[model samples]
Target chain A: MHLTFYTIWPCALFNINRMQSISSSSYAVHFNQRAYDALNGHLSEKSYSKIFIVVDENTHEHCLAPFMGRIQGTYDFEIIELESGEENKNIDTCTQVWNVLSELDGDRKSLMINLGGGVITDLGGFVASTFKRGIDFINVPTTLLSMVDASVGGKTGVDLGPLKNQIGVINQPEMVLIVTDFLKTLEERQLQSGFAEMLKHGLIQNAGYWEELKEVSHFKLMDDLIYESVQIKNKVVLEDPTEQDLRKILNYGHTLGHAIESYFLENVEKKALLHGEAIAVGMVLEGYLSKDLVGLPEAQLADIKNTFLGRYPKVDFTEDDIKAILALLKFDKKNSHGNINFVLLKSIGDPVIDIQVPDELYKKAFAYYAEN
Target chain B: MHLTFYTIWPCALFNINRMQSISSSSYAVHFNQRAYDALNGHLSEKSYSKIFIVVDENTHEHCLAPFMGRIQGTYDFEIIELESGEENKNIDTCTQVWNVLSELDGDRKSLMINLGGGVITDLGGFVASTFKRGIDFINVPTTLLSMVDASVGGKTGVDLGPLKNQIGVINQPEMVLIVTDFLKTLEERQLQSGFAEMLKHGLIQNAGYWEELKEVSHFKLMDDLIYESVQIKNKVVLEDPTEQDLRKILNYGHTLGHAIESYFLENVEKKALLHGEAIAVGMVLEGYLSKDLVGLPEAQLADIKNTFLGRYPKVDFTEDDIKAILALLKFDKKNSHGNINFVLLKSIGDPVIDIQVPDELYKKAFAYYAEN
Candidate 1:
């Protein structure tokens, strides 16, 4: 293995916290050093039928060459490149992968390495999960959002029409490899989009981390900060890998975030919000909602709003548009028996799972955001 | 629970030898006694979010009333009836069911009961398996072939274009409740179709049973025989739930059976081969192939051929027709690579799985049958 020196330690040493255990299978998230060591060991395992790499057009151009270069001759493998976009993540693409793998005589013993952002990790993991009932796969996350959020959870799937993640299976990969090097090729807007999730991660779990995050805003700092943000998410996912309870904490910004994403996707002429962009907006509005549910200090709420507004200048929402977004919230996949349940924060750092906000309270919450 | 009397209990209670032990999530074929006793269980204990019964317009007219009366107060549910016949078991119908199910708020926890013949069982099970990742379902098979074949294996899916079971998942149902009483309303041709699989069960696993089967032709006697056939399948499935090895024995006649079934379905003027009817022809032809593979006495092979031809008359096959049928053999979903594998019999009661048959052999096998 021709390993490049990313960190000072020629042979990097690291430890991982085993916080989450899944019922169906087990998986590990290699923080730094362990992740690098795992690469050699995985390639040496002689029992696999074949190794497969799933990438997108963008990742194939930027990430695949460097990623494969590290372990070039260690294993025999093949590659499948999918169209690069969230719009292509559906059953049609899944069928295409299934057909290709079947034609290649892929069997259950094969391993899949998903080397891209959230789209590749999600769609590739999903394809491996359903192929021949299930197969082993690894997530090599290249984006900050996928590293901190998507890669840790076992949720793998694609969207259906206007619905997000409407079709999917909750199957964890065998391991996840988070290498910061891929971030170098990420576009500036993509880098900014991913940082919003990191900010939300700090806000939901660690008050100390939230305080530490008051540092100056630049996408460059993500490298030094990704480890801590991943830990916060890793802790919650470990507690509830299936999103039955504690995992709901991760949905702090996603409730409204998804609605805004869906709304803008339909209204294509309007500028589309990256998943993280919508969540940034979600955190601001939900902060006001949190103030009503539990007494978050006025200073903290204002700080949350001003911090995000400073990075992402406010996108105006008319009353009608706000109503349409609110209507979409009812269709949220998490809702039970057609009732909208919001994940509200008790404080900037702590979140309470499965709190049902009254319809009247939702109306009030939206009006507060509109007036503010 | 309604207690029912059985003529044979300890005498007919044959344990499936291949299954080491039953798993909690195992697909159970509740033959004679167990199927009748399950009516008393509450719907809440069934682990389904909602219960859906899939019936055909014909079954709605003929068999729905009697079956609904049995499990009426046990659960509050709705019936989804589709158009009758093998012709409608395509992707178009599956899409319609998906649309209806999406609007009904059907999620993973919902249960689908296939309450008619093979078409309902196959298509309904397909719909349930693909709906919202997958849902729990049951098979209350009213037809003979479905009760013995479709209900036993978890291969649920719909046909794609001209291909059968092209889009599907191999997910087991919670239970299979085979009520033979509903067979009273089945047309004679449908009953004959179901009988084909029963003969296959006898031919592949029990020479003694196969000998005894030659004497029985009545519906009442067929019910007892169907239970035995289900036991054979249940035992094989329990051993290899995913069709890796021993389960291939179940495909005794299906290779040629499917080709003939598809051929009949495509031709309008020609009478369609009921699943069993096609298999009857397949059994006769494969019986000849078995003669070549194993040293079967000429008398035994002749007896098997005469019995099938006597029961279900042969359909003429021209050289060109045989070539087309042979080409369709390549599309079997069980095939991974380009190789065409067959489950050939070593003896009347023993099937050898994964026998690689050359393309030349298919031509010879067809030529032998075409002349016969």
Candidate 2:
């Protein structure tokens, strides 16, 4: 594999306060009280045919009333709830929601607000984009995974069979509302799933962010971290809207990350790891490869290993599991012309893309992850 | 509704040769020999992981062998075929194709060639667009309806139940290959269905073209007409990619035309008319409303009525059928905030969009359609 250097996106594109909203190409990501205000103003400004809020059972019970209470206008909104799980995030669910929207008289001018986690935002964003050849939608992300990741990058899709996010589109929402209160609704496991992505934001684009993120004792204490993670993500997305080059860096750990997540999800006996948990394992395996290929320092490599292992315990990978996981790597979206490409970090805050790692090194990388 | 004048897309954007290709936002429409040459050049140029050619049953039997014989490359291509007709143009069919793509190792770098009528191009385009957040695709339209209308415009979508094209996105294919020879495979009724769009194009934009179109006794002899019709369609689509304002004029007869089409499609007892056959009736119905609503002259209205009636025999619509057709208009993608909008003509070749005709006039319009 040959080394190709890429320009890292600037951390501070401009000086702004901690709570300020970040804007991408077509939409803005508003935070907290400002998010609700922006939504209300937008609602009042445009004459929508209808307003539909998409939620999972958890969000419908928890996030919906609070989200609706914040609305300042006298608008009627229909709540379409789906069953919450990664399994439910597929084309079949999208069909059900689409049928509901059509049955409820949802038209071209209808506004859809996605009020759950990544599944809600990704699935709901896709539903709005395709229904009637596109409709306006807002993402009121209610989980850390969605806010830090799916909130900025217009990556709306669902899993096709065992593959992760195999069907979807990159169409932006009208706006993204990041409410930290919704983050509190998540359990430690789900919250940590999002936290893993924030830590990735630091490792790929900002060393200071990685340093600050690694120091956080509690996952709940993340208002500032969410802002910083989104800034890093938004900066990367703005530079590459359609994910040509610079955007692949955002998929740094996601190369093996998605494959690992898919393997765990598909295996009948294995307990399904949360999105971040699977990615957490991916970072370690890829980090081991980065040390040899990208000259990642020994001390920093150790730091990376310890930082994640502290929260994410190592899972038992049998020989069959490892073989299956390796087989799934070829199905990754990043792959082209039958070669597995890696987005490796030259160092913290420095990323190199489209680097091929040979098939021979797979076992060694897994050995490094399994080592004391 | 007040009269608003829109700048009609010019016939002579630039004086290119008769058989020359026409360019849209990102892709071009290549004719006959030029179409085959472009496809061969495209196939040899890109290193695609897999080449998927989407076809319907009819195209698989007739269009595929001839289409494949033109290709100069030795590249392996996979054929994914679906059931023909508008009934198959829905999310369920899209799910089947998407599954087929995943099952076979179709990836981001794969190239899709749509080789069928409008349903194939529309559904295949959506499948390619959403498969792994979109892959590159080309269109080789195999019907007169598809060649003249769906060739230039990047309107890729599937029908939602009874509503026509109520689901999908405005995504462009890599290139479109328009081969007039394939029109021979279409039945007389199907050819007339496409001819309806050609008539509408001339009515909405060019009276000189309309006069020429009326002179052609056979739909079989339409090479220059197809080129000119695509030129008109391409000019309008280029000006407005997302159908915001100027593009609305293209929907001249489609407002009531789609409603009539859907009404006939949903009722199993009623014979399902080809798209253009229903639109021919719509032009008569809407032309009557245009006389009173948009100052359409008596002579021009008679010209339109006689031109369409000469081709399409009148169908007896029970009073109930007329009521059901009118009720179906509310579900149209063009409607906004519960207002039924129409694209009415001030005269031949000049149309005004977003005009509302009162309920009192719909019955009168139907009566005018029933006139001797």
Candidate 3:
């Protein structure tokens, strides 16, 4: 199903024609302008029983019409609008979608398009995976974070209460269409949240991409680089579809990031951290953990902190808060047994997964904030 | 995996020295006397992590120890007892088993041995199947009906509210051990309930078996014929696993039986019809439906009706009540679209599936019951 997506780019911007590819098995991560075009073209060719585009209430009001218009298909499509927010990402909402699908007499042949941010994609992907055992779905991520992060991997689930992704299965989507144009409609906070993951992609895999991104402060200039980030994620995910080994590296900032996200979610008055924003902080803190655990070069650790601190200077947490966050990390779903395994950078461009840090190192990592 | 189970029976009564082909999926369905020998064999050869014997409350108190003592093994197996009755067959109870399994760190290499009647086998099979996607379970059916019906087919599920087997998936057991010795512990009603299914199995598939069962009034007389009934059920199940086509023959009495079961479960003060009892009555009423739908011979219908009528007599249901019962059949999970489908007999031994009878015929089937 080939599709043509139009992007509103500046006249003088060097448009590299952003393309992304996602793989579940050990398939090479293919990324270029042609790959994205090919994927879109492939989807447009199939005649489905129904075109069901699931979105959150926010995205339904914001992004659905243009998405329907952009697709070349002449088929009629239906929208299942879900409530927007992390709190609503759960099995209850999945029941609602199941009801809608059942009421509509959706058969094995129907297509479910998740067109929104992470919640829509995550929940929609989960619903499709479990509906009648399983079915096909495509992800059209609108948020910058979802475009670069959620779109590539098939990690789809709703939170089980405060326990994130406790009840879920591993199922990959058939295709993921990441259009950076959707980023234009995002809130600045959401934009920054997504950009953090993109920076992590550069930090963990490609030094050249990191150097290039450092030179450009124009947020729009990062749009073309989303494909590069997706490529790195796809490579990691494809190698370990079931998260047995290599995929743990992608959890770089997520260990502490999830704890922070869960903490703020419970303390409703506190500022909510978008996943990417929390993870950006997590990446910095985890970078310090890497320095302590793996003897990462001190100079490289300073560079990682300075780059994130320069962009996100307002993030402030006391050592006590870090202690609390560290406690939350212990309950991370990824952790097996009692070990608090951290995925840390071997260097600026390499991530080594399953690195265990001692309790004292966690204190030292938090102490770095005081020294700074 | 090899598991040895024993029943108190003379060695001369059991047979099966001729069939000795061993494959990876080797499961021995020990019937009656042969079940006694199974208990006397070495269990480690059965390849099981932990031997978990599932039984209901009633079975636990009355027969658990005797059954356990008969099944000699090097290691004393843990008895995971459950509350008796169809009411306890649900996700909550399954959750109890899951919690136990999780606490025990039961892996994919574990085995679950279901010991009781239909409830233990069905619910236990479902718990094992879904615990870690799937697991192996052995069904040791103590009741006559489950021996021939439930144990043969891999249909495992708990009821959804008043609905029978509503939330379930199809998964076959690794082996079925039919130990009729346990039948001595059953109440008269439970024994009769189980006999009803065995009669229906004979009526639908084996006319000779049906004739043979006619001479057997007590569990002791039918003990000799238990193997014959189970083999018929196993053959039919092997031919059609999912009940998509010919598997419906097994549902010969189920159409009206299910409606009757559901009706009593909701309105009547007395206990609901046991599955076999309900299906037994269903066979007689559906014999009338089959007369028109499949041109079932009058002599054959009369034979079916006379056999069941002689055994069960008639349960009271007003003309209005029969109409209501027929209406409830419309919501049977087996029905596709809006039609009420049935497995009607073409003759005493030939069964047809997916047969849709007209509303007038449905009314006639029940009206015939009232008139007779």
Candidate 4:
């Protein structure tokens, strides 16, 4: 029996307009112009003992200069820069950040501003949350993927070896400020990678949203699109902060996506796929599985394959590659009691979670993806 | 100006008794025979896909064999052992444990039983708390220090360099089982070391209990003393789980004790001090400071010094050693805005938090300790 659970969070605390910020519990997510004011207001109000801005090499150059110019507060803050990439997102990186915070005498009252992509946000959030048993942290997501997905969830962690997010905690940041201005600095491939998650938000929750997103041929800094995606994810997260049941739906494509991502990352022969690109392939394969196992419409499955394959280049997974990916599935965070669980769509925007897909069907799913 | 805030946690959820288990928000601390039953019952009730018992070298050899014989469940469990010492309680150890858990396919439903002293409990708690954004964990504290201190607080972390608990989270375990039977295997020094924290519980909060603890000449398996110490700490932690105010009293000697411990551990010439032994010296020095800074009575200060010095041999610190220990004070976790904050007793059991000490008074306190 499939354990499907979804609760469309009332969005009771959110303000939809660009002028207003979305508040949840003790924090808020500020967008575009509102983000600038939120950061200014937060710094102006709280007398933090010290301030730290954590960034990656890329964000230090591309985002920090503009952010520093626009930010209203004149407080002294140290810039902690890490090497940019998913490869550096590990305990060692976290140790370096923690040591920096400690050596710099960051106490309970200090504030940490995570100022980069998912790697920076994730690693910074984990360090801040665990440092001195937690300190105040705010996220200024520089990458599109981080702004819409990583920043919204409060999921802070570093990857362990080839395993993705194997070590982390689900602690919310004090605030998340998303400014589309950083998008200009992103490479085309990076921009496309983030767009995949936005596509996911639409596919898993709102059919109309999927249709609207599909019409946009080029990626741009659209406040409305970012806001909507954040709203969808925030709503789900707030309803189930611990990801006990309802939140599992968010991992619809991630089950296979994460394994595939890890496999490519570990194998020297395979080119490293960006998170969104890997998950894009995962969506197509899972879409086929959904049609076979959950009676999703075959036409909708074809549409999903066509849409994702058109945007993300198809990866040629040899049988050995597929076997390695399958081997990595046991490490999926969602799995319990040694059972591999999947979240599949019965129809567009309608998901069924905890469905056990047979190995034979998994082989067929790959076969279908290969043909596409 | 001292920022003193104490909210006597309503004690709304606690049941004080020798026979009954003490329940917290998400966990319980089971004592003596009750611990065995609690473990058996927990394992029987929850069908964990895999069971892992994490221990240091000491516990694996001394405690694991007997623990295995007594455990009622028939489920197979893996033994993940680490080296026995504070030096091993770092991110690297956590990485090792995480890798083992990952290699063993420890999913969200797997259960990890931390069976050892403070180092094991702290490191294991941190690893379990972060692995897969948390999994089910039960701490089986073998040492007296862990039973009364680490087991009560939801503080889980590993040390960064020489700084104590520099990186960690305040996430509680599923339960903690305290079996004094393991104490028989402990060395006399280790036992005496743990006794210091129990002494601290009384000195910080209950003068009457302090008088009673002062009367003991030998360290034995006194379940009642253990229970009371646990009760005192649990009360303080429950009131201020985040250590924002009232809970600071628990760190009465810890500020100096941690620095001294870290100092000794880092210097090759200085012998490693057990957590409690360092804190014992810390209590004596702070007790002198309490007399000088907070009007703790001279006679009570003498009694505190006499009682601890009689039990723990004095470690002669050269002028350089004093300076090094004092310099390490800046790294204390309680410091804020670069100022060292100490918890001093106005009288035995009556403590004040966030009291800044002047340099002259600090030097005088060290001179007093040296002379004593």
Best by DockQ: 4
Which lDDT value does model 4 have at B291?
Answer: 96
Q: Tell me, by TM-score, which candidate is best.
A: 4
- Give Cα distance to truth, residue A133, candidate 1, Å: 4.7
Scoring model 3 with DockQ, what do you get? 0.12
lDDT of 3 by residue, B3-29 (tens): 234344222343343322111124657
Q: Which ten residues in a row have the lowest lDDT in candidate 4 chain A?
A: A1-10
DockQ, cand. 1? 0.20
DockQ in order:
0.20, 0.63, 0.12, 0.71
- TM-score, prediction 4: 0.94
Per-residue accuracy of model 2 over A11-68 as CA lDDT, tens digit each: 1111223598788999899988778778878988998877888888899888876777
lDDT tens digits by residue: candidate 3, A1-372? 111223332212214463444454522233334334544475667657666788876777777665554455455456788778998986567766776765554544567989898888888887786564456787778888888888776677766555566444456676776656567787777887788888888877888988877776766756457767877887877777667778788888888889888877766667877787778778888989888777678998998888877776446777667777776775576655446678898788888987887777766665674466
True contacts recovered per prediction? 0.09, 0.80, 0.00, 0.89
Q: Residue pairs in steric clash, candidate 2?
A: none
Docking class of 4: medium
- Global local distance difference test of model 1: 0.73
TM-scores of chain A across the candidates, in order, are 0.89, 0.94, 0.87, 0.94
C-alpha lDDT score of every prediction, in listed order: 0.73, 0.85, 0.70, 0.85
What's the TM-score of each model vs. the native? 0.83, 0.93, 0.72, 0.94
